[model samples]
Target: MRRVHKALWWASWCWPGCDNQAMLVEKNVPLQSFNSFGILAKALSMLRVRSDADVDALLSNPSLKAVPKFVLGGGSNIVLTGDVKALVLKVEIMGKQLVGETAKAWIVEAGAGENWHELVRWTLESGYPGLENLALIPGTVGATPVQNIGAYGVELQDRFDSLDAIDLVSGQHFTLSAAQCAFGYRDSVFKHQSIDGEGGKPGFGLAGRALITRVRFSLPKNFKPILGYADIEKKMAQSGWNAAAGAPSAMQIFEWICEIRQAKLPDPKVIGNAGSFFKNPTVSLEQCADIIQREPKIVHYPLVDGTVKLAAGWLIDACGWKGKSIGKAGVYERQALVLVNRGDRANPVTGGEVMTLAKAIQTSVYERFGIMLEPEPVVV
Candidate 1:
């Protein structure tokens, strides 16, 4: 096995025609800068992947390929528990363009490294408007489908066109349509691991095996704004922008969503946090009814499929965890669904502390409501 040192390789140092020479691998790199949670950690080895060529080059090195690898994007949705042992591939691909347009839709593609919120703003500015509902969500474009991120009544799957990725194990590039991603409520094939037996079901799981290079969104033409989300409704009423006058434009909704999120959620730059710490647990109508009988003031919404989605923040607040702290990790005062790093840049929250507080909240919520709150961020 070849050992990586803390150094940079020059272009002339690499072999001609082989990508390995171009891929620079750094060692013992500090990671507090990469993750949004501001947790201090280190990567034993890390490589910045700017393109598919970089991936190919890294794989061409037998020593690098022999070890486990971790694909990191914006680091907004992960809690680093400790130093990463795997080779870290930090995706930094960059591009944004209108790939094509049909009678019904416009397809816009972005590199995996592009900021999701910026992408939304770009789409609206570029005259493609469907992604406005999802504005201000943290993390990179590539991580969106992995989490099936949604906000203001719109989910990534609703805007997804397709994505191109490379199989880490085979080093082969492949494309997957939205259906192949199998997106669900804060879940996707990327969240699941490959099954050993049964050859795995089609469109099942691909976690840890695929590195998404680019993502394409299908923004419909002649767009209609998706409104009526409680926050959006509140904003509309406050601004006196009635949907009845005419469906508010995508730009208006985007601005409102941005304002709403800023008011509610803690800025990661100012207060380190990974958006929502828990997924809003979904339950059967019967379960919701039973909980309602006991709690009476429970917050919930009915889904199209006859299920109810409970407000995880409401559950957490009911458990009296808002603004509560365990060492350097604490729940945001404004939103119980979020967990913040109470420490400063020099001494940030540790991953262990975050998980401990998370587990405690999970236990309390489960004990009271019989529903275990599932965490939204990936615990690494």
Candidate 2:
């Protein structure tokens, strides 16, 4: 028995050629609806792939040729509206390996399937020092680089070294640099790939077929803390953690961030939410100067380019959308920016509800600040 199982396990990894039905679960799996923002959708087909070989075989399943494909990691950032039409690939792989760590820096790779918070904990325990400020971020490591997730004054591009992704169509895998990702404010090549529905770069067909296998982060071996965000600084002071003296290390920063997140964002398990639903709008420095001249309390974060990033949440709250609940969906009273589904729809509000809420928030923000806040997720 051991011989047969061992041989099969070995084959699953080494062969990369298995087109077997026995390895995959076919149909009848109901995904849990308690995703961070709690909208539920039934998967047309879902597979938890662990190996490159599995990825190859699934892509080759000729029976599924007509269906579109999407990978789900942690399900932390997405808001599933209704029944999905695509084959949802749930990556079940996990583990961590230090591909490279030098005296000056370190590189850590994690499975696309791993949880963001879990990975953050592992890094803290392992003494890595850069991801602290990014603690409590939703989604998986594989998904993180795509959004270039950022918070509390630090962005992913600040630490992103590189990543590996597999092309879904031709089964070709490739590496990407920070530059190739074209990291804008919560945007990347993967999310922004033009759609003829797929990657249509005029002459390119395989322009957008990529599966993020793993992501690597570069971190300083030496202790370097970033303390620009006011909340982080205030919390550091609150926790009696200092940035200068053998003070707030990366682990402490991670904990502080986690604490702050817990206090601010509603637990998705109890309520359905996708965290912050809108991107902070960036405006010209001149526009910012003009606005602040009127409302001196307007908070802004400066960008590398002379422009400034405005807080979308504050703007939404200012528009009086906070505490507004409609049917099963509502905006959290404390956090005006997040859209929450209070309960399952009986006569559930249509996808139109989400749209209406989005439009109202967008219009109000634009009117108040003269800057438009864009939705961060792919609304399909």
Highest lDDT against the true fold, candidate? 1
lDDT tens readout by residue for model 2, 1-380 = 33442112212322234443355533434455525655555675666778776777666656553467777777776666666667777776777778997778889888887888788889889878788888888777888887879888778898888888788776787888888888877877877544554455443222236778888888888877877777787887887765356666687788888898898888876766778889888889899899889878887888788889888888888778898865666888878878887666434334446667888778887787777788876554
- Cα deviation at 285, candidate 2, in Å, is 1.6
Question: Candidate 1 residues 155-203, lDDT tens each?
Answer: 9999999999999988999999988998999999899888645565554
In angstroms, give how far residue 277 of model 2 lies from its true place.
0.5
lDDT of 2 at 57: 68
* Residue pairs of candidate 2 with colliding backbone atoms: 37-272, 37-273
Angstrom error of the Cα, residue 209, model 1: value is 0.6
Instruction: Give residue 152's lDDT in candidate 1 (0 to 100).
Output: 81
TM-scores, all candidates, are 0.95, 0.88
